[model samples]
Target: MGALQGRIAWVTGAGSGIGQAAAIALAREGATVVLTGRRKEPLQQTAATIKDDGGKAVVRPGDLMKASVVGRIATDIEKAFGRLDILVNNAGLNITERSWRQLKPEGIDLVIEGNLSSAFYCATAVLPMMRRQKGGVLIHTASMAGRVVSPLSGTAYTAAKHAVVAMSHSLNMEECVNGIRSCVVCPGEVATPILDKRPVPVSKEDRAKMVQSEDCGDLIRYVACLPPHVCINEVHITPTWNRGYVAALQQAHVGAGKK
Candidate 1:
């Protein structure tokens, strides 16, 4: 039997990228996965892929930016599964504005609402169920920008990611006694669709050198499968190439006028 043979896991932003990969990975481990995203078609695609692999999955499409929708999702999960063993707060987005001077109020709100507020709403919504079970795992997909500022990631994105890390730590401190574990993953750069949102376009060659979504999926699966007694508080994953450090330099020198 798989390590998560009877577990129930819900992954937000499960349509594409890291979220989809993580949901599939958990299902592969025998968890009944719940896939949630803004788009129904992509969520259905993820669910179908899981079913194709002989794993169980279902799709729940909604706008996570709304606290009410997030609450409804938790309630729906409770009604359908009666229990949730894992919650992956993986929904997030960034804007093309890299600096505060270039950032607009609407852009900041979009980043904050999509990245930070959504995570907060989802975590709060599920905490009661997790506490009642007296054992569960919460995984937040923060960014390397959380640990340090990156010119590539905009100010709003960086601020929101930093808050995610802080929130994860706070959850651990407050809820570890309740048998709840919270882990924040800080990845430098991954070949996900989010890269397309960057202010400066990344070359295919550069993207190839970055970490892949599956790599993060594997890491999250490893973290989730550990014994209940073990709590991985935070993890920092970066590709061997460490492009976040060099991306700025490359844009200035190599990518100039390259389109």
Candidate 2:
């Protein structure tokens, strides 16, 4: 039997990338995964993959940015399963016009809603169920930009991610007593579709060297499977290549030669 056999897990943004990968991994471990996203088609695809692998999945499509939608989803899950064992709050987005000059008020709102507010809504919605059950796990997908300031991720995205990190930690501080553990995963340069929103075009070679979605899925699965007594507060992960570090070194060399 898989470690998570009989557990019920809900994964947001499960249509593609890290969210989709995490859902499949959790289901593989025997969890009945609930997949949610803005679109229905992608969530259906994820469910199909899990079903083919002999795992179970349910597609619950919604715009998580709206509290009403999140509330309804939570109610439905509680009614159907009576308990929630895990929540992967992985839905988020980045804007192409991320810099200060290009950042519009609307863009800021959209990024904040997608990355931070939605997570808050989901976490709160499940906390009651988890508390009643006396144990649960909340894994948040943050970014390295959440740990370190980065121009590449743009102002709004960076700020929103940093807030996500803080929010996850706050959950741990308060909810640990309830036997609920919250973990925030900070990963660098994942080669997901969101990369297409980058202001600068990323080369195929660079994408190949960056972290993959499956890597994160495995990490999340490990976190979820740990003993109930053990809680992973945070994790910082990066590709072995370390593209940001390499770029900084090359820029320093160019500046020295010009001087």
Candidate 3:
């Protein structure tokens, strides 16, 4: 449980939701956490909580959608920590179903670039450092929407998440040779501030029926605590009330048939 003690971890989207929770969890286990997100206040808030709990943390605020910033964050981590021990690519984004359907070129670019490409960019940036360090952990946060589309998220999100799945799998294969273990975490609907960014505000009662976010953080801790060679390729977590998102899909399919 305490395996992460004294380790250094970089977690994106750390301003809130799974990213925020997971960052604190990692810190509790002895990891010096680097919290990143577009908002400075929220990221610093997360860092403050960790520091209050006798944990180490720093904040790096930026729009991860920028490729240049991705590289810069990695460089900053290298400069600050000297050696990278863990990389948690936990940032993500989604749009309204209608917006996604409109296929605005910029939206397409943003979703793909932010949620998907950023992982590779950050991972690649850290790979050489990890290789030199002899061993490291790479954990990418993906959505269950990547596993299957749902009423909860839109096409842009699903597309971006699918790319994350593909990229993580490839990373697992490619980085193993360098003593780096890569894995993706596919979480079900989590009740966190990410819901606030949704086109619709998901109600607390409704979110409670979904996955408990602490569970997601625990899984990250589990992955981090595993023995060497025990790379859990992926984790699929969801609410008991939700099953394969069958209801949402059934309605979508039936509605399409009506059209």
Whose lDDT is greatest here?
2
Query: Which lDDT tens digits does candidate 3 get at residues 146-173?
Result: 8987555777778789889888888778
- Cα lDDT for residue 257, candidate 2: 100
Residue runs of model 3 more than 4 Å from their true location after superposition: 97-100, 150-152, 197-201, 243-259
Task: Give per-model TM-scores.
Answer: 0.94, 0.98, 0.89
| lDDT score for candidate 1 against the true structure | 0.93
lDDT tens string, model 1, 1-259? 7899999999999999999999999999999999999999999999999999999998999999999999999999999999999999999998777697898889889999999999999999999999999999999999989999856687888899999999999999999999999999999889999999877788999899999999999999999999999999999999999865576687787767775
Each candidate's number of clashing pairs is 0, 0, 0
Better of 1 and 2 by TM-score: 2
Please give the lDDT score at residue 39 for candidate 1: 96
Candidate 2 per-residue lDDT over residues 1-259, each given as its tens digit? 9999999999999999999999999999999999999999999999999999999999999999999999999999999999999999999998899889898899999999999999999999999999999999999999999999978898999999999999999999999999999999999989999999877888999999999999999999999999999999999989999988898899999999999
User: What C-alpha lDDT values do all the predictions have?
Assistant: 0.93, 0.96, 0.83
RMSD (Å) per prediction:
3.9, 1.0, 3.7
lDDT, candidate 3, equals: 0.83
Question: Which sequence of candidate numbers ranks them by TM-score, best first?
Answer: 2, 1, 3
Best by TM-score: 2
Model 1 ranges off by over 4 Å: 245-259
